[model samples]
Target: MRPRKLILCVEANEQVLSVRKFLLETRGYRVVGCASAAEAIEYLQGALPGSIDLLMSDLQLPQMDGNELVRRAKQLLPGLPALILSNTVTGYDRAAAADAFLPKGACTPAEILDRIRILVARKRGPKKQMPTAEMMPHEMAVAG
Candidate 1:
């Protein structure tokens, strides 16, 4: 049986969507492309929880923006992997929500695909359990 492929792609531009669709299909991923954040929300509402393996979104979108989409999608699917594809990314753009950032103007298709692979690998790997300071003697002593 073919492996399950689940992805949410939100981009406003038609050309970008086409390219993204091509890239994802080439990599054997089943991509769900949406033109806006509202559309993404609608799609997610119908999909099963944990069905989306990754969310690839453009930073700028109409109605609702990419950051907001990432924020809301995470609330619905905690631990859902996200990647940002934007021409205007800033330091503040690097957040816990986005696992990887692809510079829209600078990155080639190959680079984007490679980054996707890396992010997917990270998601498939064992979950990271953060050690609380109070749970670690050394950390608690350091804090104290």
Candidate 2:
């Protein structure tokens, strides 16, 4: 069987954090829930490369907003997939660093799960390779 995906979830609100943690855990994810950006950053810094599959955080964090967190996370783990959640629709415009964004109360659990599944699968998908001269068709290569 495939190993469960590891997710680093950051949220300031305890109730929201617990609910999200439970939701993801029950869906077969291994979650590391943190109540602040500092805690999440510490975890990321100490974690092995490619250990965590995703970073999910709330938009309204106390110290650092989710976009900044996503940016910092990308610096640490270049290709790590990130998802930012917010209670308002306006957060989408500010979530440029995240791979996906969801309005907290607007989305159902199924929708959130579906988006996460898609992002994770996308990250695990085969990478596209640049075509070398030898890989090109004979005619195309000769024409170049």
**Top-lDDT structure, candidate number:** 2
The local lDDT score (0 to 100) that residue 92 gets in candidate 1 is: 36
lDDT per model vs. reference:
0.76, 0.85
Each prediction's number of clashing residue pairs: 0, 0
Off by over 4 Å in 2: 127-144
Give the TM-score of each candidate.
Answer: 0.79, 0.86
- Runs in model 1 deviating more than 4 A are 89-96, 127-144
What TM-score does model 1 achieve against the real structure? 0.79
Model 1 Cα lDDT, one tens digit per residue, 30-94: 89999999999888777777678789999889987787888888887777889988787573354
Model 2: how far residue 18 lies from native, Å: 0.5
Global CA lDDT of candidate 2, please? 0.85
lDDT, candidate 1, at 103: 78
